[model samples]
Target: MATKSLKAKGNELAESNKQLDILNGGIFAEGELPFFKDKINEIGHFPLRPKKLEILQINVGYMCNQVCEHCHVDAGPDRKEIMTRETMAQCIEIIRNTGAHTLDLTGGAPEMNPDFRWFVEEAAKAGIKDFIVRSNLTIIRANKKYYDLPDFFKKHNVHVISSMPHYTRGKTDKQRGDGVFDKSIKALQELNARGYGMPDSSLRLDLVYNPSGAYLPGDQMALEADFKKALKEDFDIQFHNLFAITNLPIARFLDYLIASENYEDYMYSLVEAYNPAAVENVMCTNTISISWDGWIYDCDFNQMLDLKVASKVKHIKDYNEDLLNDRNIIISQHCYGCTAGAGSSCQGTVA
Candidate 1:
């Protein structure tokens, strides 16, 4: 794992505005690729607006155990930002009444938050149909205190969506960190022992496979098949599904693209694979992303870029879904990532 986040290293890319400048100033400024708004406008979809809310994707903190090279959150042990119980209380209040059906909890590793369990236990009571906890897997083995995480999740029926990167140890460890593969395998087994990912269980245990590098993921079903075969044969591990997500160019990923001189080519790839149908179901249209400090955004990507919602309601403390639903979704070059190919969202492909 990287010893420090770009923010801790004082890398300019840590600044959302700096990253936005690069995203907005590059080949985009020279018309090498159409600006995201123009691309959307070609289909009469400019000024992207929200639809009926369906998911509440909340970032409880940025503190995480690993520093994956492609991490858009730039989360790591070095990150100190965390959500306080007070902010979480506000979230629970909204959760108890929101019309949204899915409640997604994310972070550097949301488990790192001091009040993570308290928040989960409270939110679970809201009776949301799909309760998700985006776990990093290794965190379940990082410390003894976390050993019971699988049991806790099973008790609450929290849908465990873990980041596996690849089915092979080499690719998995390379993208996340050394020893991550072994630990993740163990964690998956433990989750299995608790009935997660088991074919006969209702406990949903899904693995997320984002490309280890600057490339779009292949077919989700094919990748899921390969992962199932490799994992079941190699480790007797089982997961219900695999979500193949496109790596949006932002945060550490954008840094990698720029440092490796693949930014332009990657942008070209995204533009070439742009699927107009994908734009209609982008996460921004149905989800509201809340930051660690309670600020609201159109989506997690926009949250990282510090793009607050274009509405009167701007924070969780002041959440007004009706007003929030009536706003334009922000767009920029990075928007291409979510609209490319089959289209990527938190729930995997849309088209």
Candidate 2:
């Protein structure tokens, strides 16, 4: 088991190295790929800007338990970047001042943050309308100490959004790690026992799905049906909703695309499937992504690419709602990923 795990880690490192090469090689340079602005302009919406700051997506850290093949964050257990209490305090202040309805907490595993529970407890006290935790599922069952997470989540009413690559163990384990499938199942059952996803229960649990390869995800409703049926019959698990997310071309997935000779094809696919309508409701329009160190970006993908918001005020300490409200979004060819097909965001399809 250790040998297989080591081999997987080696492969992950190799892909990450390849992705760094491609990113450093100027994959975002003009003419290297289709300009996102051109496509939007052709449709008569040239420069995209923020609509309203409805969701503040805070990336608390990059320390994770597993290294998935398609992770855009390139996060793992080895990552040292974790959000400090000072920075999180600044974020909470912004949330209070801005009255942002939803606090979307994300990370390598947001729960893995040493101060995660404290943050949640305080944030709830601040009266934020909704608390969304983007979990990896397996983390809850990763250790004996984490076993109480379900009850903890219930106590705080934290809406759990987990990533389940596929309903089947084979595809899921392939994309995630070797034994991830079994762990995820146990974790889901635990969540179910806690009234999460139960009919008429206020505690909501949603699962997110992203294609394991370069292709876009299938229809959200259809895929959700399949996931619901399979999980219920096979494991007797219950969940509220399934969100189908399109994999953006970046990080390990970018490396996979280039290594498999699918880089250009995948980029073009995003550009080709551009939905003009999807642009109006893209998550970036209402969401602001904050890195662990407090720098701001239009979305999580932009954060990974080191693309800050176009506004002069770029950090949480200097967060200016007036400046950010009307500021033009910083975008590139990668923007196509969010606008393609049914559209993709942390919430799921836009159009």
Candidate 3:
């Protein structure tokens, strides 16, 4: 009976996805992050100071199995863009020269890239202190080739950060497509078996949560407890940590806001909750995002909006730490998502 229900739900989702593709014209469109806009206007123009670049996040490709409703990357299986070996080589050279402590790999599914493992293996050889793979979870179980990713990550001691939109199947499926929740859970259990979430285990597996609707996420610590309890009770899964991320208003999510008529209300919420302290620790101050094509941006959200870094060095081949640090962060309404409440960043709450 459960199997039948799951199959029926999957079929329904397939039909919904087809309709979404039509509504989006096969390409995700931009929507408003009202709060970001209001904050930008109120704060006026302030120059961003470059602290030492500690983490370099590289986008390997835009190919993904599922097109979620709130995706900021607007990535899908149809996306043909993938990073070339030449660009990867350039990034490696930058890593060698820059002495950045961490390398964060992200994508529609970073594992989908042919060079994904190669990049990880090579980067591991570089002796970087931390390696992180931002996975969508479902990809680990979606293909035979990727099934061994947990072991691969274990071999490299890679810190795995994966998305699981909600603890409940209903909400998670609604946001990420049907069967995603089940696959994600199975993948998590596999990671746990390899000592990912266990105490004293070197393998770290963290789950990422973003609200399915237009509202901001509740308290991070509190939400983590709920997730930990739910996943443990229902699926016998364990993870090292839970990161609550606010969905930035850009890309597919922005399109949802415009389509659902929630754009103004969502923006107002962000602006109203703005805390000045959040601005000081915004992730862009400490991190830089590299697109699949090798263009640099202040952060990943900025990258999707085609907002290039304000620095003279805009690409990896000619990465200039001094110039990038001296440049101002490109400001827009979308930024409010990062600065609201306790603040949110790729690594979770900034404040």
Q: What Cα-based lDDT does every candidate model obtain?
A: 0.93, 0.84, 0.80
Model 2 pairs whose backbones collide: none
Model 1 stretches with alpha carbons more than 4 Å out: none
TM-score versus the correct structure, for each prediction: 0.99, 0.92, 0.88
Clashes per model (N, Cα, C within 3 A): 0, 0, 5
lDDT of 3 at 111: 88
- Which ten residues in a row are the worst by lDDT in model 1? 1-10
**lDDT of model number 1:** 0.93
Return the TM-score for candidate 3, rounded to 2 decimals.
0.88
lDDT of 1 by residue, 1-351 (tens): 466799999999999999999989979998877899998999999989889999999999999999999999999999999999999999999998899999999998999999999999999998899999999999999999999999999989999999999878889888899999999999999999999999978999999989999899999999999999999999999999898899999999999999989988999999999999999999899999999999999999999999999899998877888988999999899999898999999889988
Candidate 3 lDDT, tens digit per residue, 132-206?
999999998998988899999999889999998899999999998889889998999989998998867888788
Q: Which candidate is the best by TM-score?
A: 1
* Candidate 1 displacement at residue 99 in angstroms: 0.5
TM-score of 1: 0.99
RMSD of each: 0.7, 3.3, 6.6
Cα lDDT tens digits for candidate 2, 74-180: 78887778998888888878877774789999998998999888888888777788889999999998999899999999999999999998999889998998989
